[model samples]
Target: MDKPEKGNPADVQMSDPGKKSGKQPVTACLICAAFFGALGSSFIYGYNLSVVNAPALYIKAFYNKTWTERYGQPIAAETTTLLWSITVSIFAIGGLLGALCVPIIIKVLGRKGTLLLNNIFAIIAALLLSLGETAKSFEMLIIGRLIIGVDSGIALSALPMYLGEITPRHIRGSIGQFNSILICLGVFTGQVLGLPELLGQESRWIHLFSFLAVPAVLQLCVLPFLPESPRYLLMERRDEAAAEKAFQRFLGKKDVSQELEEVHAEARAQDNLQAASVLQLLKSPAVRWQLITIIVVMACYQLCGLNAIWYYTNGILSEAGFASNIIPYITLSTGAIETLAAIISGLVIERIGRKPLLIFGFAAMAFFFSLLTVFLNIQDTVSWMPYLSYVCILAVIASFCSGPGGIPFVLTGELFEQSYRPAAFMIAGTVNWLSNFAVGLLFPFIQVS
Candidate 1:
């Protein structure tokens, strides 16, 4: 195909009066596609992250109640602690398992298919959680969390891949950042719903766990109407007609020839190439640097103590001298700050580039964590110390949202060519979940020590 002339219809269609060159204008279809895609996927991952935190005491009591009922004796504190740890950590373990399955699922089902099928995990998780209390089975809640973890794991990998495949090249970064926005929304929504007036109660706390299904059901209902990725249709399936239709629907315009041609050229270049597996990726020298970069960045994203702070924010705040009743409100405020920072980062990240935000975010987090430590140690001695600790924690949260929190998902799509991307996400997702599991499982022991 020849390039469109300067005044050609294709050229005119591609450029808006105020739009940047090579960038697609934001359309209603794109917004709906992105919102529904992330709503049931990455959003759930964020929701689940903070949801369990508010109901910790109630859930622990339920665990003990079920254990004692089953064994005809009161559950020991150590046993309850062990059981609770398993409950919290199993989600990440399940996430690791989900990440491991990405290559096969995406290859066989395609990106959209994988997401559609993945909704089953969410439904199952919700059912198990809603029934856990009624059945007097603590194991049900554990299993439900694990299933939701698997759902989240697949979403973390697949949603970004789908978003990347479907969006235009120039706007991809901004659109991709929307995943983090949805996750922020999910976390904030979870925190709000977990408040005492909602489902965060001694007797009604089970609703918080069951509410995971709402987004999944919405996604399941709406997904059939959205287009499958044009890139996936063209590159993987070699279905040009379908890919053209997909591009048209996604762009909300008829002239998708330029965009379609770009995807076609990329697909043609890799005509006979096969996707690399996880082991193959590690052993291949050609892509070793790319693989290592993703691994290191993903490790930093998870192991930077963000999850530890999030999972146990109340405890951290209590130690910082915040009263118990106000901790929920403070936790809600952090989510708002995170979402706002991510929005600002999305606006600027494309202009300033990813590396700078990442650097500033990580450096700022380190500085604030150190300050937080000092504040915690001397809060009783200094009248203004507790306020300093609050500022430090909020700053850490803001720094994370600005760069490290969302940049990695964007980078996974950017750093690798199409053929190597699945394998990269597979390895990176596994490392991320494993690191998360380590934090969730071991943080309690670390705190105890």
Candidate 2:
């Protein structure tokens, strides 16, 4: 590992308190890039996670109806369960595939280009899913889920890289939280729209998937006007002038000489190393601990059981002794709490820093998860126990969003230099999607047992 040069602008800005006061303001272009980028990216991932929950029964019914028309017999219970599992789990499979593609895609397209291109998957997925009922093909819905998962897989990697590179280091963590915040917002939006008064009805469930197109279209319209990542330009393309212009737009400043010099110093430090492949990244001792940290954090991010909550909110509420009629409304609270907690985390992350928040969040989650288990086990004996169980669930959600929900993505970008970043995110995305697949596929069985 090469040490930063003495008085390197990047190192000075990071180490010196006085220099922090001179950090550039967050520009409108930067905000739009982060907002619209996430709108088209992680938002779709979160929406798809929860949207299917409200429409699960309807989608299953559609599956059965399609099977019966073709086979002259209704789908078997076992078969329906299997198909539903595939429908839910296949997203992770697609995500895994997308993660595998990230290194190549990001290298070729750059972060912004990759995000813009990813919207095609979202648009196509929306079409397949929204029109699945009209087409009388449940397979289309399954395929759509897979495609949108690819969109998420790519977005999760590319969006973070773009945001991390574009922002001044002073506000990087806060800007990175856009990914987590929009995801919560997406989950909340899905929950709100999935209500019976909206599109949750059997007749209207198709419209839930149609809503995927709105964010994709919004990003398509807005993101083109924004700049590509300055770090990517300067480090990879060696286009100093273009990188300077991008920094100016993102930082809302005319003089980006310090920023340019920082990237130049980093580029010189790397000695013109090419963007590394996943295999090369893994083989290098330089990033061993960084890679390990990413793997563990990302695995924990998915396997800590948040997706299980999002995927089966209704079922979890039912098990907590909530009435079937009230479960949907109760589920909405989880999304709301998650969004609120993530917003708060974004506000304080730079001040509080990442490690403390992560430790506190995970510790609080463990406590709440244990408490919720006790409350659920005794809910039948006491009227208030179920409400306590609900509170526990909300607490777990808050704990997660407070840190673990967002910081891993930020860390993935922070830990690696430009050469290793794409590969680093690819590895993180792989663990993330694989763990997501395990939860989506196995959680129902776990809950049953």
Candidate 3:
């Protein structure tokens, strides 16, 4: 690696103990970028997932009232069910559309730029949802859901890419976990706000969607001051001066010659390659196994039944013989457990490595899920069995967040080289949202069966 010229502005190295430990210090700027970035992006995605649940009856009632006013008759039960299902499941469809747009959008906008523009979807969706009641239009609410889905799709891909690129290799896993942690926090926030005493009531439910603007606006204000991805600037834009400034800002040090050289080396190695398209990525034999691994992992990330838990928290508790009034409070615990587990995972992922945590999480989930089934079946025979089922639910959530909830995102970024990353994420996001759509559309029917 060639060192920067002695008089270069970014050539001054700060005194840091991590130099001796073969690690880099986590900087304030790096932390802010990750926190605010995920706050607006992945947080909204997770919030939307759980936010609809507590307001389900209220939303359905609004649907009915709108139908009655428009048609001079009440909606049929089957049609009501169908409309609600579409409202819940259409997010995935929008996400699929957004995922398809990743390659071109990121190429043009850059990772941070893509995220900034994505807030447009969130803000528009917020307005549509919050004002749908006053407008007397159910379609506005559905459209809003779809638009926000697009926002989430783009954010999911871009935020991980940005986080992965900005952080040093030593702390990459820890920083990447921010995406998952904020998601868990978002789920918990939705649950908290959805309480009847809060925004979950018929009159207050519209406010839930309105809250989306807060983080979006916050990110818009905070993120512009932060640096763009050093790798993106160096590799894609070939703007060495700007990349050096970005590297210095993110690393919180003046001497970034080694970091610059690493990216320069990668760029030289891929000098023959252009940013790949989805078709090209699919056809390339070199990345065949990498593509397969990402696809399988992303598919399982959605298909692993975690969403089912979020979608059916109330029903699950009710089935376990819990009183209706207490189930909402109990539901909050699941989100809390999820957030805690993800935090713990972030702390230890670099030390323990990704594969072990993933294997352990999946195995533990299987065990607890089976135990939950047994307890659910036997709850009627014993007074204590329902509590056991509750414990099992918590265990399953903890198991999931410990590894499987977050590692897939980290792996998607890690598995591919710079040129392939955008296309790779696009493919992974496609599988993810498709599987998510399948689960959201089919899970109710499957549960009934």
By lDDT, the best candidate is: 2
Model 2 lDDT, residue 328, Cα = 87
Indicate whether candidate 1 or candidate 2 has the larger TM-score.
2
Candidate 1 structure quality by residue, lDDT tens digits, 324-380: 998898889888998999899888887878889999999999999999988888999
| TM-score per model over all chains | 0.94, 0.96, 0.94
Write the residue-wise lDDT of candidate 3 on 1-449 in tens digits. Answer: 32221211111232232463246577899999999999999999989889888888888899999999999999998788778888888988989988888788999989899999999999999999999999999999999999999999999999999999898776778999999999999999989999988997878999999999999999999999998999999889989999999989898789988778878777776789888888988987777888888899899889988887786678778889999888889999999999999999999998899999999999999999899888888889998899999999999999999999999999888878887889999999999999999988887777666
Candidate 1's displacement at residue 220, Å, is 1.0
lDDT of 2 by residue, 183-288 (tens): 9999999999999999999989999999999999999999988999988898788788889899889888788787787888778877768778889889887778
Alpha-carbon RMSD of each model:
4.5, 2.0, 4.8
True lDDT of residue 174, candidate 3: 91
Residue 209 deviation, candidate 1, in Å? 1.1
In angstroms, the error of model 2 at 376 is: 1.7
